[model samples]
Target: MAGNDQAACADGPDFGPLAIEARGLVKRFDGVTAVDGVDLTVPRGAVYGILGPNGAGKTTTLRMLLGIIDPDRGYRRILGADRPHDVAHAIGYLPEERGLYPAMKAVDAIAFVGALRGLPLKEGRRRGRELLEQHGLGYAADRQIRQLSKGMAQQVQILGTLVHKPRLVIFDEPFSGLDALNQGKLERMMHGLAQDGTTVIFSTHVIAHAERLCDEVAIIAGGKVPFAGPVDVARDRIPAQVRLETRAQDGPWRAALPADARHEGSFWFFSLPDTGIEPLLRALIEGEAGILSLSIERAGLHDAFVAIAGEAAARALEQEKPEELRR
Candidate 1:
């Protein structure tokens, strides 16, 4: 329904050259629809993101794409393959619920997971050791996962995902339990993967992470995608804002301001006018309004998310995180 041709196809579905494509993907659990007619396209080598809340069907959608679970209706393809298992060797996935053998050594755990992905045990062990050393976990290789810190354990899981050298990497709520430092590390890892021509796709409720790491994103709320596209396109969906402050917040210069301008705490804020700010600046100068400051705040991913999904949903996601995490 959302820009998808739902009609039956005679020649089968054409997913074009996309790394990932979903045509009217739908899922239901106990009569309740988890994913409702969603379609997505992730270009090759691009960092794509699914932005949504905890229960917004993000996990369900990802699971369906991975063939971990089948959709009730519609179809999905990955790396031009009709099923995930067909290209299973070409993909790496990190699930939201972290899992590892607590009694297993860090390196062994990684090697074991890699072996499952078709990598030889010896090769997996070699690559796993190198990855651990590169990620500053060299000394912990022989240590049991239970003996490692939460962050270190998480890093081990991430290394296992990469040991196979997959062409596409998918992360489901990768930032869920990490601290800011670990989150930063994960961001760098995603960048590194994309730089190596890996198509990275991650789902998270945190919009800031998407803004920092993703080239394209789809915003889902209440099991429906209200917006999806390039990061710049999402930002452009809302108008920019202008904030002005002056000693005198009145008189003829005030008349030049847009009707939507609102006065709050010795400042005037409003949507930036399409004509230009030059005319407004000139008017203020001529009227001797003593302009203290003027600035334009370009719409950002967070603003676009709020505008599209509403403040209630935004607040629900933000909660009361630390200032640094929010930034």
Candidate 2:
């Protein structure tokens, strides 16, 4: 409801303060650059998302950020601390792969991890109870971890991440096994956390999930970032597509559009042009076909992702050695 005080998480880099600056991050594996030079900054109480296709180096980046691995070259300042993982006591991290102990009771497993993150066993269990109740999983706390469904397990992992009251939360593929409703629940929880001033960073393969949940996003492909900005601003990277929905039998704008643009039923499609489709639409109005609706369709985050991915692919192809392409 309140968007202005969006700095809810980084009130001063103390309680889950701003922890989103990574500079010139470079990671290499076996003489191959997994993450090329890249710089990113996220504020406190901000929902920052990292997105890319499989094998696009997203996991490597997250691993480095979590301190499970370190960058060969780079620097990061998180939560006012130079080392993010060392401050695990205040940072909650949920890896993409589920790591819950199958035989342990869900509640006990959660508390155990909280304890590892620095909570006393008693307080860990107590806080675990509160988190379960808060996230609507109180009834299932006593069940064995393996007995829980995939969605339930995911919720448990998320609960565990936050059990220790970490200020900065990192989630990799948080929506992995969720149906729409469950995903929505997780999204709501994420929003609630940000509202309470927790700097939340997540990595996802799906553009839509990141688009909906993040205040800002970084789209990385082929170890390069082609787009890193606000969601609405990213949409403008691709020229806005012009859509026309009408019953007119003879739409004059059809031939002017790119060959890839299609006409289906009452809808005529056209990609954003250099000068935009404005002059063309004005021409249509002058011709008098009785316009129904003529507006620029907002490009989705997926569209922007695809646009950058295509560019990366092209660049990679150009940079690929002749021997590599032959193989």
Q: Using Cα atoms with residue i matched to residue i, what is each candidate's TM-score against the true structure? A: 0.89, 0.80
Measured on C-alpha atoms, candidate 2 has an lDDT of: 0.75
lDDT of 2 by residue, 1-327 (tens): 112222233222352445767888889988999999767788888898988766677788888877888889988777777787557787788887878889988888888888878878887777677777766788988899889998888788777787777778888877777777887788887887888877788987766678788999988887777777788888788777778775455656445556667777877777777776767767667665567887887888767766767865434433432332334
| Regions more than 4 Å wrong, model 2 | 1-18, 245-289, 311-327
Against the correct fold, how does model 1 do in TM-score? 0.89
Candidate 1's residue-wise lDDT over 110-166, tens digit each?
999888888789988887888888877989999999999988899899888878888
Q: For this target, which candidate reaches the highest TM-score against the unseen true structure?
A: 1
Off by over 4 Å in 1: 1-17, 247-249, 286-288, 320-327
